[model samples]
Structure formats: C-alpha cells, structure tokens
Target: MLSSWFRVIRVKFLLASVIAVCLGLAINWWQNQTIDLVYAGLTFVGVIALHASVDLLNDYWDFKRGIDTKTKRTKFSGGTGVLPEGLLQPNEVYRAGLIFLIIGSSVGGYFIFEKGITIAVILAFAIISIYFYSTKIVNSGLGEIFVAIKGSMIVLGTFFVQTSHITMEPIFGGIVVGVLSSLVLFVNSFPDFDADKAGGRKTLVIMLGKKKASNAVWIFPIIVYGIIVSGIVLHVLPILSLITLFT
Candidate 1:
C-alpha cells in the first residue's frame, strides 16, 4: 500500500515538490549556520505533507465536481491513485487530506510560535491560497498569481522561521522558484485546457488557449534561466558550488 501510494504521487509531481522543498531548505541553510535539526526536519515534513494535501484535495474536489471523468482519468492513471478510479471514496480521500493538513499545520504553527510575527502574514496567504485554488474564487484566472505567491512564500517563510530575519537573498531565490514552479503549472494546464474551459475554470491556459499556453511554457523557462544566469554574472549572487547549476 505504501509503495502504491508512492507510485500514485508520480515522479514528475514528486520531483517538482521536492525541488520546491530543496529551494526552501537551500535558502534556510544558506542563511543560518546554527539551525536546529528538529526544526529543519519539521519544515521538510511540512512541505511534503502540504504537497500531499494539495494533491489529495485536488483529486477529491475534481472528482466531486465531475471534472475528473473516465476519459480524462484511467483506473491506474489520473488524479493521484485510487480516488478517481472508484477504488477509494471521496470521504477517504478527504480524510487523508485532512490528516496530512493537520500535521502540516501543526508544524507550521510551531514554527510560527517560535519565530517572529512576520510569518503570520505568509501563513495567512498560504492557507488562503491553498483553499481558494480549486474553489470558486480561483476558477476566475486568479489562481496563477496565487500559485506564484505560494512558491515564493515557501522560501521566504522557511528563511523567516529558521533565521528569524528577512533578506534580499531569499527574495531573489523566491522569485526563481516561484517562476519555475509557475512554469510547471503552465504546462500542466495545457492538456487540461478543454476540461478546464468546460468546467468554467478560467485558469491561465483556459484563457490563453493552447498556442499561447505552449508559448508560456517555453518562455517561462527561458526567463527563469535568464534571471539565474544574470544574477550570477552580475555578481548579485556569490558563486557557490555546482548546486548553483540546478538553481
């Protein structure tokens, strides 16, 4: 069952979330030398839990709304694992998501209690964005901006909780992660274009059509890489090790 769940997550989506976690950890580690291991571990777990909650809730919501149909989702194929295929009911998926969300929020609340007040703002936005993404408010094309903010907030919030200070470095790194992760959403939007349109989900791809959505997918990576290279070349960011290549 554990292995099946792992497979359900899918490598691409898992890797993307892993990358976001790495970006958060990288920023925190870079800025702090005496960070607590337990705190860091909790943050890591929080990130993963939140990722799972988002996926599971999305599956549950999509299924409920009839957005995930038999054609769009296969028995072993779409919207996580068992949920869409009728192997699991909506209540089960909803319960799993709630459990993970509680765990994540517990860790996050701990960090907030230890950290300063700045984290409250980020947490507020994070919770709101997560809720609204698939809800009525997000179906009007505003979810893209929320997603971008979500990506950026991970790094900023991570740094704030760990270091208890804010700097421009994490801000820069946040933008990079925000834009790259946004690209992932942009591409994911492509195949779901017609469905999204049909469902009245006015997401970016739904509004732009296939051609412009494809253009966005290609353009985002270019712009992100350009910013990364520009920062390194202009000495805005100090030369680190080979890890910089991936960033």
Candidate 2:
C-alpha cells in the first residue's frame, strides 16, 4: 500500500522539480552569498507537493480518459500502472492529488505573505497550470512549453524568495532547467503518440509525426548548450558552469 502511493506520486520524476528549486537556490547563493534556511526548506516542500499533485492528477486523468489503457506501459513513457492494476481506487488518487495541491498552495500562500505580489502571481500561475496540465494544456499541444515555463518559474520563484529580487543569473539558469525539463516531456511523448492522439491529446510528437520529431530531438540539447555558452560568454553565468556541458 505504501509503495502504491509512492508509485502514484511518481517519486522519481519529482527530481525535475527538485533540481529546478536547487538551481534557483544555487543561483541565489552565487549572487547573494546567503540563504534563509527556513524559507528554502518551505520552498522545497511546496514545490515537491505541487509536483506530486500534478503527477497524481495526471495518472487520474489519464486513466479516466482511457489513455493509460491504450498505451504500453514502460519505465519512461506511459502513466504509472497503479490505476489500471486496481492498486488504488480513482477517488483515492483524486483526493490525494487535491490534498497535495492544497498543501503546496498553502506553502505558497505563506511565501506570498512574506514576499508579496511577485510570489502571489507565480503561485497563481503554477496552481492553474498544474491543475489543467494533463487536460487543456497537453491537449493544446503546449505541454512541453508549459513544462519548460514551470521549471523556469520554479527557479525564478526560489531565487526571488531567497534574494527578494530577480536577476539574469536565475533567468538564464531557469531557461536551462526549463528546456531540459521540456526535453524530457518531449521525448516521453513519443511513445505515447498513438495513445495521446486517440485520447484527443495533441503533443509535439503527434503534431510533427515521429520522423520529424525524431530529427527535432537535437533542438532541445542545442538550446541548452547555446544558453550555457552564451551565458558564459556574456559573463552572466560562472565559467565553472561549463562543467554542465559534459553531462
């Protein structure tokens, strides 16, 4: 039962949001040389809760739409098989998703109280987009874009909460993280192309067709490298960041 809950939350994929928050904090430390431990911890809890909410909700919606039923589940692409296997009831998953969403939003509310309108706006965007991501946004063929923006904002929001200001460092760092996240979603979409299309979901892979989408895979890495190189050249990011290129 515990393991089923973990699978429903997609614990491993939560790492993307973790990295995003860490990137923001790292950039804040680089620029300000300080961090508020309390705020940082709250930020992590909030982001992770929100991430879990989205994943749980995604599984619920996918199951509802019969997307999961049609797909060949794999480690990387298909939705978690928890629902199909009846490991958990649909209502239980839906409630868990909402509970996590509320927890995340409560944390954001605290930050907004401390930080002001900026945090409020970012939190608002996150809540709305997260709720609709598995439905409206993905169906519109904007899933990748939404993910990239979500990653970038997580970085921006974390930096803002810590430093009380914005800068080019977090912006560049956010873009890199955002693009990397979108790349994951873009690649994962391929195996789900048929399932997604049948469910009336329009992903980039479906929009482009597999062959063109295959060729387009190079774009994500290129954008990431381009930003890193540009940031270094412009003196916006530290030279040590170059080590990321090796990855």
Candidate 3:
C-alpha cells in the first residue's frame, strides 16, 4: 500500500522538479560563491511536494474527465494506472493532492516571510498554476505554455529564495528546463490526442496535429543547446556549463 502511494505520486518522474531545483542551486553557488544547504534542502522538499500535488491532482482530474479510461497506458505517457485499477478511491487521490499542496505552500510561505514578497508572488502563481493546469490550462491550448512557465518559475523561485534576488543565469537555466519540460508534455500529449479531443480538451498535439507537432520535439533540444552555446559564447555562463550538452 505504501508502494502504491509512491506510484500514485509518480515519484520517479519527480526527478524533473528535482533537477530544476538543483539547477537553480548550481547557478546560485556559481554566482554567490556559497551554498545554503538548509534552505536548499527545504526548497527541494517543497518543490517535490508541489510536484507530487500536481501529479496526484492531474490523475484525479484525468479520471474524472474519463481521459484516463480512454488513453492506452504506456510506460511513459499515460496516467498512473492506480485509479483505473481501483487501487485507491478517487477522493483519496484528491485529498492526498491537496495535502501535498498545502505542505508545499506552507514551505513557500516560510520563504516569503524569510525573503520577501517576490517569493510570495512566485509561490502564489505556482500554486495557482498547479491547481488549474489539468482542468483549465490543458483545455485552452495554453497547456504547453503553462508548463514551460511552470518549469521556468521553479528555477527562478528556487534561486531567488537563496539569493533574495534574480539573475540572468537562473533565467537562462530556467528557459532551458522550461523548453525541455514542455517538450516532455508535448510529446506525451500525442498518445492522448484522441482522448483529449473527445473530452473537449485541446493539447499542443490537438492544436498542431501529430506530424507538425512531432517535428517540434527537435526544436526543444535545439533551443536548449542554442542557449547553452550562446551563453558560453557571450561569456554569460561558465565554460563547464557546456558539458550539459552531452546530457
């Protein structure tokens, strides 16, 4: 049952949020020449909690809308199979999601008190985005845009909490993660194209059609590499940051 809860939270996929937070920390250290382990640790936990909330809530919404029932489950794209399999009641997932969201928000609230209203703004927007993402954003054809902003904000917020100010490095790093994360959402939407359409939802896949949207996948990597190379060329980033290209 504990393991089932892990699966419900999609713990493995939570790495994306972890990576974004780490990227922010990396930039903070690179600029400030110091690290705040306690703050960074708390930020990581808060970010992951928020991420789990999004996953659980998404599962709840998808099942409610009947999208999960129609889409063929895959190792990569489909919703976690727990709800459809009857491993947990729908309300259980919904409550769990809310619990996680509250935990994450409390952490953010602490940061806002410690730091300033800037953190408050970021946290407020993030919480709002997570709540609306599955229901409203995905249906409005702005799903990809919302996701991209979500990833970018995670980096920015994490960095701001540490430094109490924003900078170009985190912005650049945020853009890289933003585009890549959106690419993940974009690609995943393909399998759900028919499911989304029938349910009155419109993802990037539904907006562009499959063939054209598939080509957009390559654009993400290109933009990521372009930012890295350009930042290096302009001396905006350290030479070592180039190594990220291989990854």
Candidate 4:
C-alpha cells in the first residue's frame, strides 16, 4: 500500500524539478556569492510538493478520462499503473492529489507573504495550470509550452526567493533548465501520441504526427546549446558554464 502511494506520486520523476531548483540556487550563489540554506530548503520543499501535485493530478485526470486504460503503458510514458491495478480507489487518488495541491499551495502562499506579488503571480499560474494541465493544456497542444515555462519559473522563482532579484545568469540558466525539462516531456509524449489523439488531447506529437515530431525532438537540445553558446558569446554567462555543453 505504501509502495502504491509512492508510485502514484511518481517520486522517481521528482528529480527533474529538484535539479531545476538546484540550478536556480547555484545561479544565485554564483552571482551573489551568498546562500540562504533555510529559504533554499523551503523552496525545494514547496517545488517538490507542486511537482508531486501535478503528477498525481495528471494520473487522476487521465484515469477519469479513460486515457490511462486505453494507452499502452511504458516505463516512461504511461500514467502510474496504480489506478488501473486497483491499488487505490479513484476517489482515494483524487483526494490525495488535492491534499498535495493544498500542501504545495500553502507553501507557495508562505513564499508570497515573504516575497510579495511576484511569488503570488507565479504561484497562481502554477496552481491553475497544474490543476487543468492533463485535461485542458495537453488537449490544446500547449502542454509542452506550459511544462517548459513551469521549469523556467521554478528556476526563476527559487533564485528570486534567495536573491530578491532577477539577473541574466538565472534567466539563461532558467532557459536551459526549461528546455531540458521540455525535452523529457517531449520524448515521454511520443508513446502517448496515439492515445492522446484518440482521447482528443492534441499534444505536440499529435500535432506534428510521429515522424515530424521525431525529427523535431532534435530541436530541444539544439536550443539548449544555442542558449548556452549565445550566453557565453554575449558574456552574460561565465565561460565555465560552457561545461553544460558537455552534459
């Protein structure tokens, strides 16, 4: 039962959001040579809660729409197998997702109180998007756009909480983080292409069809590299950050 709960939350995939938060922290430290371990830690908890909320809510909605049942499950793409397996009731999963959403929102609310309207705006967008993501955003072919923006915001938001300002470093770093995160979502969507289309969810893969989508997947890494190169050339990013190219 405990394991099922963990699967439903998709803890394994939480690392992407964690890495994004770390990049934000790293950029802030790189620029200011200062650190706030307390706020950094709090930011991480809040971001992770939001990430989990999205995952659980996504699964709940997919199941509700019957997409989860029709889709071919894969290691990377399908909704967590928990619901279809009957490890938990749909209402149980739905309630759990709400709990995580509330927890995440509470954390964001605290940050808003401390940081002001900037945090409030980002939190509001996140809450609305996450709640409707699987049902509305993906169906509109804007899913990837939202995921990418969410990744960038995580980086920017974390940096803002710590440094109380935005700068080129975090902006460039956020772009890199955002693009890479989108790539993960892009590839994962491949397996769901047919399922998504049949369910009326018009993801990028569905919009472009399989072959064009495969060809377009290369663009993500190129954009990441392009941002890195331009940042280095413009001297906005330190040359050492070029090490990202090797990654």
Candidate 5:
C-alpha cells in the first residue's frame, strides 16, 4: 500500500524540487553565509508536498481523460499505472492531491506571514497553477512554461524566505534549475506526443513535431550551460559552481 502511494506520488521526480530548494539555499549561503535551518526544512516539506500534489493530480486527470489508457507506459513519459491497475481509486487520488496541495499551501501561508507579500504572491501562483496544470495549462500548451516558472519560483522563494530580499544570484540560479526542470517535462512529452495530442493537450513535442522536437533538445542543455557559464563569468555564482558542468 505504501509503495502504491509512492508510485502515484512519483517520489523519484520530487528530487527536482529538492534540487531547486538546495540551489536556492546554496546561493543564499554563498552570499550571506547563514541559514535558518527551521525555515529550510519547512520549505523542503512544502515544496515536496506541492510537487506530489501536481504529480498526483496529473495522474488523476490523465486517467480520467482516458489519456493514460492510450499512451504506452514508460518509466518517464506515461502516467503512473496505478489507476489502470486498480491499485487506487480515482476519487481517492484526487482527494490525496487536494490534501497535499493544502499542506503545501499551509506551509506557504506560514511563510507569507513571516516574509510578507512576496511569499503571498508566489503561493497564490503555485496553488492556482498547480490545481489547473493538467486540465487547463497543459491543454493550452503552457505546461513547459509553467514548469520552468515553478522551478524558478521555488529557488527564488526559498532564497527570499531566508534573506528577506532578492538578488541576481537566486534569479540566475533559479533559471538554470527551472530550465533543467522543464527539460524533464519536455523530454517526457516526446513519448506521449500522440496521446497528448489526442487528449487535447499541446506539449512542446506536439507543437514542434517529434523530428523538430528531437533537434530542439539541444537547446535545453545550451540554456543551462549558458546561464551557468555566464553566472560564473559575472561572479554571481561561485567558481566552484563550475563543477556542475562536469555533471
């Protein structure tokens, strides 16, 4: 039962949020040399909750729309096979998604109270976009954009919560993490191109066609490396950050 829930939550993918938060913390520590461990831990829990919400909600909707039924399942692309296998009920998943969303939002609410309107705005955007991501955002072809922005905000929000201010360091770091996050979605879309199209979803893969999309894959790495190199050149990111390129 626990494993089934974990599968639906896509626990492995939650690592993206972890990386985003860590990037924000790393940037803050680089600049300020201090961190609020309590806030940091809370941020991780909140972000993970929201990430789980989005994945769970995505699975629910995909199954509901018959999209999951059409796509050939893969480790990366297709929806979790939980529903199709009757391991869980649709309403149960939907409720769990809402619960996670509320848990995440509660954490965000606490931050907003502590950090002011900045956290408020970020929380609002996250809640609204996350709830509608599969039903509307994906259908409108803005899924990739939303994902990029979400990742960026996680970094930015984490930094703001700790430092009570914004900086180019977090901004640039956020973009690198955000773009890399979107790349995951972009690549996954490739395998689901046919089902996504049939289900009235318009992903980057569908918009560009598989052939063009394949060629376009190079753009993601380029953006990530460009930002990293530029940040190092500008001295915004530490020289040690260059080690990321080796990965």
Candidate 6:
C-alpha cells in the first residue's frame, strides 16, 4: 500500500526538488554556513512543496483547460492526471494538491515571519507570479520569460535565505541554473504544443509562431549559460568561491 501510494509522487519531479535542495545546500556552503541542518532541511521541504504544488496545479488546470483531453493520454508530469488515468479520484487529487499547497505555504510563511522582508517579499512575488504563469493570466502571454524567471528564483531565493542579502554569486548561478531549468520547461512544452493548440491554449509558442518558439528553445539557454560561464571566467563570481561549480 505504501509503495503503491509512492507512485503518485513522480520521481522526476522529486529529482527537481532534490536539485532545489541542492541549490540551497550550495548556497549555504557558499556563505560558510549561515544555515544549519534543521533550517536547511525545512527550507528544502518548502522548496519541494512548491514544486509539488506546481506539478499538481499545472495538471489540474490543464485537465480543466482541455489540454489533457481524451485525445491526450499522458503528460510528462508529477500529477500525471491520475484522475484521468482512473487510478485516483478527482477529489483525491484535489486533496493531495491542497495538502501540499498548505504545507508549502505554511513553511514559506514561517520564513517570512522569521527572516523578515527580503525573502518574504520575493516569495510573495514568486507565488503570485507562478500562479498566474500556469493559469490564463501570465501563463499564456509571457510563457518563456516567466518560466525563465521562476528558474532564476531558485538560485536567487537560496542565496538570500542563507546570506540575507543578494550578491553577484547568486546572480551568476541564477542565470546558469535558470537557463537550464527554463530549457526543461521549454522543451517539455514541445510535446504538448500540438495538444495545447488543439485545445485553444494560447501559449507563447502558439502566439509567436512555433518557428520562433523553436529558435527560442535553442537560443535562450545558450545565451544565458554563455553569459554565466563568462562571468565565472572573468572573475565576476569571485575566484575564491569557484567551489560552487562542483556543488
């Protein structure tokens, strides 16, 4: 029973959560230990919860939007539309999503209350921004940029949470991981573009023409990573902190 329930938690999505935690670990390491195990673990759980909500919310919204209609069977996802799969009830999915969302929000609220404005303000913006990024509001119109931005925030938030200040290190690391993360979002969209367009999903790809979108799929990451590596080489990231590369 436990193993069966475990399937509901997507491994790939969990790996992404691991990456976020690793980012926090890296930042904590960079700052020479401003965060200890308890705080870091809690914060990592918060990050995982955010990623979980994103997966669940995205699936629920897509199901509602007809993007994952009968013709569309499965998506590369954490939720995987289990309701559609007949493996779980709709209400069950909702409950799971809500549970994760509440836990995630509670953790974030703790950080806000304890750490004050810097992390709190940014997290508030991130929540609002990402929520809209999946729904009709910001999701369709400014898809690429929004995805890129969320990717960047993993690094940004990690840096600030540890040091309580923003610095060039996070900026550079943000761009690197940000572009990689954005690339993941961009490419994953490709498999779904047809269904999305069929379902009247007006994503950036649908709006700008898939041709441009395809170019962007390639161009955006390269350019962003190029800048990041260059910054590292030019000593913009501080040579002493080069240990960041391995972590």
Per-candidate RMSD, Å: 3.1, 0.8, 1.2, 1.0, 1.0, 3.4
Model 5 over residues 3-49: C-alpha lDDT tens digits? 99999999889999999999899888888899999999999999999
**Of the candidates shown, which would achieve the greatest TM-score relative to the real structure?**
2
After aligning candidate 2 to the native by TM-score, how far in Å is the CA of 161 from where it should be? 0.4
How close to the true structure is residue 28 of candidate 2, measured as C-alpha lDDT?
86
Could you give candidate 3's per-residue lDDT for residues 9-41 as a string of tens digits?
998889999999998998998888888899999
TM-score of 1: 0.85
Positional deviation of 247 in candidate 3, in angstroms?
A: 4.5
Error of 6 at 173 (Å): 0.7
Q: lDDT (CA) for every model shown?
A: 0.69, 0.95, 0.90, 0.89, 0.94, 0.65
Once fitted onto the true fold, the runs of candidate 5 whose alpha carbons sit more than 4 angstroms away are none
TM accuracy, model 2: 0.98
- Give the clashing residue pairs of candidate 6, or none: none
- Candidate 2 clashing pairs? none
For 1-247, candidate 6 gives per-residue lDDT tens digits of 3442345545465675467557756865866755666767777787777777666666666666666653444446223655456675556655676677778778888878878887777678667764555576434666657656666677677666666777776777666666666666666666677777776667666676778888777686567656656776877665654454454
Question: Which structure is stronger by TM-score: 3 or 4?
Answer: 4
Write out the backbone clash pairs for model 3: none
Q: If scored against the real structure, what TM-score would every candidate get? A: 0.85, 0.98, 0.96, 0.97, 0.97, 0.83
**Model with the higher TM-score, candidate 1 or 5:** 5
Best by lDDT: 2
- Compared with the true structure, what per-residue lDDT tens digits does model 1 show for residues 102-220? 77777788877888567767766766666556766448787667677777788777777777888877777777788877776766666666666666678787788787777767677
Best-to-worst lDDT order? 2, 5, 3, 4, 1, 6
Count of backbone collisions in candidate 3: 0
Which stretches in model 1 have alpha-carbon errors above 4 Å? 1-12, 70-78, 240-247
Over 1-247, each residue of candidate 2 has an lDDT whose tens digit, in order, gives 9999999999999999999999898888877799999999999999999999999999999999999999998898899999999999999999999999999999999999999999999999999998999999999989999999999999999999998888999999999999999999999998898999999999999999999999999999999999999999999999998998899
lDDT of 1: 0.69
Question: Model 4 misses residue 29 by how many Å?
Answer: 1.2
lDDT at 27 for candidate 5? 83
lDDT of 4: 0.89
